[model samples]
Target: MVDENAGAIITVFVLGVVTVLHLLGAVPARLVLIFGLFAVVLLLAIGLLVLGEIRDGMRDAR
Candidate 1:
């Protein structure tokens, strides 16, 4: 279970880094802003999913 979550966390982190790089002009596109927005949404979703997992774990511990 932990290994799976770790994979997801890493993926999200990498995606965020890629997004930042693109925002900084490493990636050229006519819709840079759109890419940024998609990145933000992906990050938010990953964060929320992780948060829920953590909360569930805490509840189980209690």
Candidate 2:
């Protein structure tokens, strides 16, 4: 849906900004480490959400 795509775009944008900050040493090393861990969890949650949506779509198609 349009709303979902919009949310994904915002999420990607934020992740990009965080990554740039980490790369530029703008963020503290320890805090960057914590962000990295959070990024992993965030990615996994996004992946599961996408997979679930796909499965539901497929069921509807049947």
Candidate 3:
């Protein structure tokens, strides 16, 4: 089973880093926004995939 908590933590960490970079002017505003959105989407996709796996596993167990 995938670790949902770990995925969330990593997503948060990446978002924080992106924000810091934006604040430091290391990355363009548009790029930062894109990355942030991408991170959120990725996290959601991963969570869904994990849930699907869990569901499949449960079905197989029966």
Clashing pairs in 3: none
TM-score of each: 0.54, 0.61, 0.68
Best by TM-score: 3
- Per-residue lDDT for 1-62 in model 3, tens only? 34766777787787888889889989778877887888888788887888898899999999
Name every residue pair that clashes in candidate 2: none
Worst 10 residues of 2 by lDDT: 1-10
Which stretches of candidate 1 lie above 4 Å from their native place?
A: 1-30
- Local distance difference test values of all predictions, in order: 0.69, 0.73, 0.82
Q: For model 1, how does the per-residue alpha-carbon lDDT over 1-62 read when each residue is reduced to its tens digit? A: 56656756676566666667777988655355565566667667767888898999999998
lDDT of 2 by residue, 1-62 (tens): 55656766676667677778978988767766676676667667777888999999999999
Which of the predicted structures, 1 or 2, would earn the higher TM-score when compared with the native?
Answer: 2
Candidate 3: residue 16 Cα off by (Å): 3.0
Instruction: For model 1, state the Cα shift of residue 2 in Å.
Output: 8.4
lDDT for predicted candidate 1 compared with the true structure: 0.69
